[model samples]
Target chain A: MSSLILTHTRYQMLEQMRIPISWVASAFFPAASMLAFVVPFAAADPVAATRATGSMMMIGAISAALIGLSITVSQDREQPWNHYLRTLPAGPLPRFAGRIFTSMAIMAVAVIPVLVIAALFTEAAITWPRLLLGIGALLAGSVPFMLIGLFLGFTLPSKAAIAVSQLLFFPMCILGGLFLPPQIMPDFVQALSPYVPSRGAVELVWSATTGSAADPAGLVMLAVWTVAAGVAAVWAYRRDEGRRFA
Target chain B: MAVLARSAEVTRRYGDVVALDRVSLDIRAGELVGLLGPNGAGKSTLINLFVGLRRPTSGTVELFGGSPRDPLIRRHVGVTPQETGLPEVLRVAEIVDFVSAHFPDRVATPELLDRFGLGDLAKRQVGGLSGGQRRRLAVALAFAGRPKMVFLDEPTTGLDVEARRTLWDGVRSFHEEGGTVLLTSHYLEEIEALAQRVVVVGHGRVLADDTVQAVRDVVGVRRVSLVAGTLPELPGVLGVEHADGRTHLVTTDPDRLVVELVRSGTPFSGLEIRPTTLEEAFLAITSQETTSKETTSEETTSKESTHV
Candidate 1:
């Protein structure tokens, strides 16, 4: 099973590399936003810059995780190659794992440009251990987003997946206070910010980078979103299987 | 011979639409059967059941004497759907290797490519291949696993004469090596060329299940042709198609029609009558069966539409 999954990952990654546009599309936006927004104003202050950098990284990861996976998964469903894969005796597990791993790889690639921009242009400071811890947390936080991507991909057509993932991504980013610090946000948004999964993700990154305490309520909500997304992803996948093949 | 696949009074429905109406079929090992039907005659639905892609609403489907849902059975079965889009990025050899990995045993990639006449295109990306090339690759992928039984659903729907012949050669070789095949196609020539037994399906039921020659014999319709400036509605004309300066009419009784034509002084010349070919047989069989079915169900105000 693992060998098949590894092969699937290798092939999927090769397919993505051949396309190139999908990775570039997800990678460009957050890095562009970082250069345009974070590097200009937030760079002078070390703590502020680090927080902003963490937020930007999550933004890039979210774009890759949500929009990228959703679009690719939906598009794959429209292909006959996917049908052939599904009918294999090994079932859909290897392909699904391959896709999830590929999404993670894309998210990792997307964050690199943001990290480079922050390291070069900003005063954001981080110890090696702190950076490692922060990277781990960010990877963990991306699971819910990946799950949401799967839900969207299996439930909707490719065109609708593109529109819907984008629509959902932006609202969550803004509401989670990724664009601006929660302290500077309006009272109502500040209150709602901690409940959003993106806030929980960014909070973990911020805490790891700056030695600040993570928000317990925010972490709990992130866990909740992860669970909810997990259920929805499974339901969507099974529904797709039933509707198309059964 | 052992039964390779069997559907025992299987019925399939999509909501209110009954796609397969208690259809029963048995495919024995070493048999190359042609599932000949017009669009929406339950050919695909039956294939889906045997493939374990869909479950029957009633009765049962078995593959290799076991349930079709068994992966053990599916592992030995291969299918090429009516339409498949091969991975655009993968080279032909890589696609063959990747899919072949699923089975315990498979044909080597190079040999598989050569057999399908895709040896030169083995290094070419699927996206760059022309329509016929991609088609060859798609059908080739089905054989890579070296399955015991193969299903080709209208495999040559859009291929030209040469491409279709190439595919037919590959199919014939597979059968010669003792592979069981259940092929569906609108092209009567394809059926005549490959299938020894022809199963004619209409209105979700089998109209005729017999040897290919027997099915052709059952059609009974004859073709009549003439070069008339204007052709009127005639008594026995079942279908009309015009080409060049002449109109072709298919009918059950050409002698009576010709007599009527002579008595009416229809000013027709260059008259000829010919035996019905497989195309006319299929059309007549399917249309006749469906028309009869329509009469039986005509009283129901709300009937399932066959548009799809």
Candidate 2:
């Protein structure tokens, strides 16, 4: 079973590598954002820079976990090869696991550019152990976004999936205070910030890297979103299977 | 012979439409059976049910003496759906390897490709191949698992003569080695060339299930053409059409129709008689069923064409 999963992941990765653009797309935004916002404004302040850098990392992770994954899943549904694979005796579990692993790999790759930009252009100083803890927090926080991606992918066609994920992403980032500190944001936006999954994710990273206090409400909402998204994703998958094959 | 796959009293309905109605079929071991039907005759639906891609609304579908829904039961089965799209970026060899890995016992990628006349194209990307090559590759993938039974739905639909012949050879060699096959096609020529047994479906029901020769005899509609003005009503005439100063009559017994034509004493010229194509013969059978008023209520409401 492990070998089968590895084979599936290898081929999926190979397919993604051949395209190349999606990888660039995931890495580009967060790195560019760091250069624009964090370098000029927050570079001199170590704690502020560290927090900003953490937010930038979440942006990179979301690009791969949410946008890229949803698009690939929706497009795969339109393929005859995918349909044939579902009919195989190995079933859908290996392919599903492979996709998740591939997305997470891309997510990891995406954060590298942001991390480099933080080290070079900004004073986002952190110990090696703290950076490792932050990275672990980043992956844990990405779970809800991945589940949300699967939900969108199964519920919509490729075109609609692309449109909807983009529609959801920018608001989640801005309102979650990834660009500016939530402390300075307007009162209404601050109130709404903790409700979004991204706020919980960025808060987890910030506390890990900058030694700040994490919001208990933010952590609670993150868990809430993960459970909700998990249920939604499973429902969507079964619905899709019934519609196509039944 | 042992039945490798069986569908007993299967009925599948989609919303208000009945895609298949009380359809029962048995694909025995070491036999090549062709399912000949018009568009929307439920040929594809039956194949889907047998392969466990879909379930019967009523009745049972079994593979290798077990439930088709079981993955282990399906391990000995192979299928190529009516339409499919391979990942455009993958090479032929890579795709073959990917599919082969899913089976416990598999043919080597190179050997499988060579068997289907794709040995030279193994290094080529699927996106670069022409339509014929893509089709051949699609059909070839069905045998990758070395399955005991294969279901091919319109396996050679868009291929040219040569390409179609190549695919037929691949299927024939498999059957010659005692593999069970059930393939669906709109072309009777395809069935005649490869299948020993032919099952004819029309309006979601099996119209005829017999040997190829027996089916031909049953649907023996011959066309008789002559220049006759205002011809008399002829016995055994299944259909009639007039064009270019000639009246063409399709009938089961051309000899009896000819004798009747002569006894009527109508002036005629340029007389000719010949066997009709399968399409025309199939139309005759369905029309005979219709005129005799044997159609169920659901059949009359069916939007599917009875003609090929």
Candidate 3:
């Protein structure tokens, strides 16, 4: 079983490598945001620069975990090859694990550009242990987004998945305060920021990297969203299975 | 021989449409059975049921004496669906390896590829393959697991003669090694080449299940064409059609049909009696089923032909 999982993961990763542009895009966006926003405005303030860096990393993780993963899943569902694999005696576990592992690897790779920019040009300072903690938090924060991706992928067709993931992505990024700090946003926007999954995700990163007190509401909502999305994702998978095979 | 797969009184309905109705079949070990049917005749549906891709609306489908829905039962079976898409970026060899990994025992990648005439294209990406090559790859993947039984649904649908011959060789070799096979095809010659027994399906029902020659004899229809204004009611006439002032009569026994026609005192000329090909035999059998359903309100049995 372990060998099957490993084989699936290796082949999936190899498939992704065949098209490097998507991976490059995930890393590029976060670094570009860092160079444009952080280098000029918050370079001198250590705490501000560190928080901004964390938010940028959140953008990268969301791209990989939410948008990229969803699109790939929906597309995979449309393929006859995927249906054939499901018919195999190994069951769905190996393929499911392989996809999740590959998505997490993408999430990790996406954060590198943000990390490099922070090290080179910003006053974003962190100890080695804190850096490790921040990485751990980043993965944890991505869980809700990954689940959301799975939900969209299983429920929607590929064309709708591409459109809806993007539609959900931009609004959530802005409303979640990834682009601007919630403190500086207008009253209405600030009130809504704590509820979005992205805000909760970035809050964990901020607390880990900058030693800031985390927002309790944000963490609690993150947990709520994770559970809800997990339920929805499982339901979507079962619905798809019923439609195709039952 | 032990039965490897069996479907008992299986009926599958899609809304009001009966895709498969009261179909029962048994595929024994070391037997190469061909499933011959027209489009929407439930050949694909039967294959889907055996592979556990779809469940029958009524009745039971078994593989290896267990439920086909069991993944363990599926472990001993390999399947190539009617239409398949391979991951475009993966090489031929990689795709084989990935599928092979799912089974406990598998054929070596190189040997499997070589058997399917894909040895030289091992490094080629699937997207780079031609339509025939891609089709061959899709068919070849079924054997990668070294399964005891293989289900191939139209395995050579879009292949050149050479490619089709190469695929036949691979399937023949597998059957020679005592591998059970059940394949569906629209091509009669394909069935004649590989299958020792043929099961004919029409209108979601089994019309004929016999050896290739026996199926031909089951229909045994002959075309008797002549130029005539009209013909009297003829004995053993299954179907009659008129075109360009010429009458064509289809019947099981042309000898009996012609004697009755002449006895009727119908003036006719340009008489032609041609032995029907397997394709014509198949068409006659399936078309007979349709006409029977349309003419009678009763549940139509396959062998009962309505005289027209």
Candidate 4:
């Protein structure tokens, strides 16, 4: 199973490597955004600037997760390559593990530049501990949403999935403080925001950058959402097991 | 002896639709079995089940005496789906190599490509190839793992006549090398030419399973041709058509008719005697089913009328 997972991971890496433009954008976008902060109009507090930068990184991570999972799963579903894969001796574990590993790897690459940009542009104290926590939080935050994308890719029609992905992408970003600070929102909205996976992820990122602890409840909530989405994906997969490419 | 493949009471359902209704079949080593069915007849579903793409809702599907999902079984099974969609960006050789990576003992891909007439296109990207070339490439990929059991769904769909004949040779060669093949196709001629035994599926059920000759026997074979000049009235003649100064007659005994015609000194210009093709047998069987269905409906309707 481990070997199969590794094989799938390798396949995903190869697939990502094939898309040169996407790779370049994912690796460079964070640095470009960080440079934007150098303008005089930006807020002076390095912690605030770092928090904002971290939020942008969260956005990139989520987008990467969505696009990676969506395209990979959708193409597999559409072409029904899984049918061929499933016929092999490797079983479902290798195939599923490969997909998850691939998405995670893409997420990892996407997060790197954001961290680098945040480290460079902000005068806010950046400790190794904070960096690790921020990375961990970002990953945890993206997992559930990525699972959501997986569900859509597996369950929805391709056109509908694409539309929904586009529709949810910006709204989730806006609600999670990608373009604005959560603090500026009305208290009721802010209170409601953490339930959103993006909001929880962004908060985690902010906490990591500021050397503060995010709401434990929010992290727990994100974990729960992730678990639920994962379960849903598996269930959806099993229910439609035999009917692939039918 | 190679176990080849086996399925015991394998059933698969999609919500309210039963895609395969309690199907069971077995093929011995080196035997080419044809899965014949019209659209939505569960041929593809059965192939998917055998290949472990779909788990049976009930019962078991085994390959080489092991569970379908067993790695040991998978190592020996190769599949080519009806819809061949190889990665467009990858070269034919790269596609073959990528698939080969999964198997510990991969076949020499160049040899398979050469056999499939794809050696020239090995370095060419799949997207640039014609439909038939891509299909040939897909078959080469299936052969790369040197599987003992191969499942080919409509294996020769887009191929020209020559290409199809070449594919038939490939299939025969696989059997010669002690490989088992289960093929599904709507093309009856292909099945007749390749399969030793043929299984007919209808409404997600196995309607008939027998040797190709046995299936033709069950369906009944007869030669029919147009005879010009004096018409001889005969019993058990299934059909007669009079057109263009010729009388077409379908009879179970063609030799008897030929002798009769010769002895009678009948002047017949168009004397064609052809054995019953698989297409005729299939049509007869399915049409018989439809006739039975219509009879049942009529009986139900008449009973309702009596009640009224």
- Compared with the true structure, all predictions reach lDDT values of 0.81, 0.82, 0.83, 0.72
For this target, which candidate reaches the highest lDDT against the unseen true structure?
A: 3
Task: List, residue by residue over B55-141, the lDDT tens digit for candidate 3.
Answer: 788999999999877788888998873234688888989988998888888999999888878899999998899888888887887
- Docking quality tier of candidate 2? acceptable
Interface RMSD of each: 6.4, 6.3, 10.2, 13.1
Best by TM-score: 2
- Candidate 2 residue-wise lDDT, A1-246, digit = tens: 887898799889879888899888888988899899999999998888999999989988877778877888888776656657766777555776688788888878888998898899887899999999999899889889988998899888889999999999999898888888998999999999999999999999999998889999999999999999888987876556322322
Clash statistics: count for each candidate: 0, 0, 0, 0
Q: Write the per-residue lDDT of candidate 2 for residues B1-308, one digit (tens) a residue.
A: 99999889999886667888898888899999988876666776777677776678899998999987677898898877333477788999998898888889999999989887899999998889887788778888788899999888778988999888888988998999989999877677888889899888877889999887777678888889999789998999888999998999999999999899899998899999887866677687777666664444544333221111
When 1 and 4 are scored with TM-score, the better candidate is: 1
Segments in model 3 whose C-alpha atoms lie over 4 Å from true places: A35-37, A183-196, A216-228, A241-246, B15-17, B81-84, B223-250, B260-277, B292-308
Q: Specify the poorest-scoring 10-residue window by lDDT in model 1 chain A.
A: A237-246
Model 2 clashing residue pairs (backbone):
none
Ranking according to DockQ, highest score first: 3, 2, 4, 1
Cα lDDT tens digits for candidate 4, A25-70: 7666555655664323244677776677677778777776665576
Worst 10 residues of 2 chain B by lDDT: B299-308
| TM-score of every prediction relative to native | 0.85, 0.86, 0.85, 0.80
Kindly list the per-residue Cα lDDT of model 1 for residues B1-308, writing each as its tens digit.
99999998988776665777888889999999999876667787787778776678899999988877666678888777323467778888887778887777889998988888888988898888888777777777778788999988778877899889989988998899999999988788899999999998876788899998788677778899989977666777778989899989999888888888888777988999998778887888877786666523321211212110
